[model samples]
Target: MNSAIESLTLDVPDTAAAQAFYDEAFGLGDRLRFTTTDAHSAGFRGFTLSIVVAQPANVHAFVDAAVTAGATVIKPVAKSLWGVGSTLQAPDGTIWKVATTAKKDTAPPSRTVEEIILLLGAADVTASKAFYVDRGIPVAKSFGRSYVQFETGPASIGLGLYRHASLAKDAGVAASGSGSHRLVVNGALGTAVDPDGFAWAPAEVRAGA
Candidate 1:
């Protein structure tokens, strides 16, 4: 079964505010599925959304737009050992990492952000990896106790696991209690919770979707 992520649904106190922030900031205004609810309290603290780009120029553009749209910049855009990137918190308190595989170039290629990668902070990477693998999602890359990148089916977004505390610090957010995460994944795992409290649900697919 080829299950892909359809949307990253967010349940915020004010759906309009959160939706507007993303739309105005990253053109992702339409990508999110917003629901006003207290089922999962405000100030979500578990997962992160990674916005990948093909060019450094696009990374810079994205970070800049995020800041302009009221996102708190945690790490400024700069050359990192991994690549060119920046980390910030959105108005709704969700952490976002704008990055590209390309290194720092005097003139990075031009592009825009369109991709979304979901990173789940696992209390135990090994256990989390085992959970998903057992559920049929294949691992694209693994770093033993450190990390695991899952390879979802066609049209699905990227999924990865990082040590909870470490990832929270990296994204500059609190690694606290988890309930209804206000996050969703369209996958074969169906509606369930991983070992670390993250939830996954089936995505609705339309004609040709």
Candidate 2:
């Protein structure tokens, strides 16, 4: 399947507030849709939005900006075994993990955040993998019973799964019960919803003149 996570659709208490935060902090600009109306009434848990960067400076810059944008600072930016890192809770309640891996070459037009990986916490990783596989989303990598990363293009935006309890612990939040996700994946699995409630919708086709 030619699938990629184009942007995240989060259910925020205030759309304008959420959009302003993302735009100011990460330069996401119009890449995020924060809506006050919709299925946002359901509380979200069981997932994380990861921002992987190539440099420690980028990580620090992002964390600093997020704080200035009024995000709840969950963990202050610091060097950990993983790399320079930090955590924040968006005004809308989405947990964001900002960190850096080994340094790599990055050209101009560079942004503070590099790649966005949406990791869903599943009750059963195997079952989740099978569900997507049946839908034609290829597996790029998998580790026995622990994790699975779906095949996506070089754009670096993709989907994956992990054990629910384990993921919740790692994110410093309690395991959440199943509910709707503020996410949407675009590609071959047009207009479908996963077992976990994540949506895979087709891109809108506009009329020609």
Candidate 3:
């Protein structure tokens, strides 16, 4: 029952342009360019990113399950290059490829975190904490209702439950919405976003890694 962030993907308007932007900017993973007739593509590991354009299915179910509370349907599920899937609009307005599992798991994330640390907002922290604890991802640490850490994943991942206001406060910015990005890598470096919107970058790792 360790529901870790095995992988993450997204849907973009210009696949080539976006992919190139990521490559030049972050320098995370290699280029895994493929086309999905219904607007689908993925960018593998990069400087600070690991997710791609191939996500697990159940786009609606995901939203229903509250995995994505403010998430919207950017593109409904339908046929594509590999099979069935959809382009979803994350709460942050970021598009994701909610593709069917039939699509091969292309970009496996880095083992850096070993466990995924998900920080939920203050309001949802309590109940969400119970949900993961019950599901079996060990809740290892807690800082009042502000934060709760869960032991999860093949990598050392720990999901946190917290509030955006607090996170923004730490970041020295006005409170805005948020979203999750799936990251993949070979050896070493693991990445995660802190209470602040800024990413807690993973340490450098090897590629053949």
Candidate 4:
């Protein structure tokens, strides 16, 4: 009844071998709660998994106990990083992992968000790159066939091809041509014009030549 879900870990593949390893490494004795299945194999599921070779007689007893506790064993127990795991859905509708833990390694997926790239989708990348270069910005990389990235002091700007139809679809605005983007740099309101005749530069431009 506690709020947190304690991970139910399982051992996989060779139970005796994995148990031996754990016994030596972590000193886990009698912690191996053997669940029986009707088949000659004990499957892993719900936070962990394992592929267990039964004593050939207690399979049905294990399967019945699990089912009575609202555990659904959905497939053949197979070997994995823990031993063998079988897919089982918990009573709460959450797909719980039931795997047999062995000596093999397992790595989860992960990543880091460094920065956000502003996709300034454009029509002409070559000309656009030239425009940014003239404006005191350095080119980082060309986004292959459709866009390019320019270095922004602490951030990065992406230049993408601007298609009128696609842009209209994207913004859900009635777009005949490119729209205006207002920018506030160092306390001044600036405007930039594209294919459309929109007011886009600040009245007072920056102080450097």
Candidate 5:
């Protein structure tokens, strides 16, 4: 059996507002879902949802839409040794990163997201990597104790593990946070919480699946 993250359910205080913002910003379609909750969450959620695009133009397009939809700019769009990217916090307090490795635009600017990655900030990357591997997810890439990327197959969203503090630094936020993660990962890994307190529920069969 192949293991993968089927989808992510974000707990927001207002589902309607979240729906509107997501639609206007990235047009994620069914790639992400939201539920209503009055959960007390503060500071960084110990995770980030990254929208990987094809080029800088595509990155700018999504960031502009997100800003127009009321997202707070956490990090201004700029060129880095790795790529061109920007960071923002959603109205509901979820952190997001829009990035791409291609510095130049090959095609016209559009909101074209190549991949959606869920990066979890773990206190111990090696331990967390072992936990996932034991659950049947294979490792796609590993950088010692700093980072780990799992092979979640082509049909599912990408998953990765990074040092907690480093993850927060990359997102341009402080590492201190409390309360619920306000996020639930649905996958074949069964119902369980990882060492970092990320909740995972059984995968649900969606319409297209």
Candidate 6:
């Protein structure tokens, strides 16, 4: 009974605005959904949603669309030893990262996203890793106590954990925040909060997802 993520529900002040921005920026379709909420969240929300693409061209396309659609640039697109990527903050205060390991264009440019990853910033990576493992989520990849990726299936949203401050730094944000996480992960893990305060709910089936 391994657990897997189905979809992510974001709590925003205005669902209409979020829907518009998401549609224009990433066109994520049903992989992401939204709900209206006035929950008080400030600074980093202890997590980031990442769009992993096929190449640098796609990375630029998504980041450009996000910026044009009113997302604030947290980290401009740049190349590193690992890959090229950028970080942005959506109008709803959610952090997003667009990245790819292929630094050069392999084929015609397209905005097709390869995967959606939800990375939780855990205070104790090892402990948080154990918590999810106890819930029947198998580890896909791990780097000692620094990071852990779970086997959430190819169709489901990817899940991972990283050191709290390191995750914030990767997203180009300060590691200080309070109030609700403003995110709910719908998955087979049932309803519960992780060690880093990420909430989870029962998975719900949606058309075309």
Show model 4 residue runs off by greater than 4 Å: 1-114, 143-145, 155-209
Tell me, by TM-score, which candidate is best.
5
Q: Which 10-residue window of candidate 4 scores lowest in summed lDDT?
A: 1-10
Residue 144 shift from truth in candidate 2, angstroms: 1.5
Candidate 5 residue lDDT tens string, 1-209: 36488888999988999999999998987777899777788888899999999999999899999999999999999999999999999998999999999889989898877999999999999999999999889999999999999999877889999999999999999999988999999997879899988999888876787
Better of 2 and 3 by TM-score: 2
lDDT of 2 at 136: 77
Candidates sorted by lDDT, best first: 5, 6, 1, 2, 3, 4
List, in order, the clash count of every candidate structure.
Answer: 1, 0, 38, 44, 0, 0
- What digit string (tens of lDDT, one per residue) describes model 1 on residues 1-209? 47456667776668878877887677864357777666745444678899998878888888877788789998888887788888998876678899988785556555466567898888889999999889888899999898899887666667899998888888876666555667666556679888877777777657797
Candidate 5 weakest ten by summed lDDT: 1-10
Candidate 3 positional error at 143, Å: 1.2
Worst 10 residues of 6 by lDDT: 1-10
TM-score of each: 0.87, 0.85, 0.39, 0.28, 0.96, 0.95
Candidate models: Cα lDDT each? 0.77, 0.73, 0.39, 0.34, 0.92, 0.91
Task: Give me the overall lDDT of model 3.
Answer: 0.39
Task: State in Å the error of residue 80, model 4.
Answer: 26
Query: Given candidate 5, what's the lDDT at residue 7?
Result: 84
How far is 93's C-alpha from truth in model 6 (Å)? Answer: 0.8
TM-score of 2: 0.85
Deviating ranges (above 4 Å) for candidate 5: 1-3, 207-209
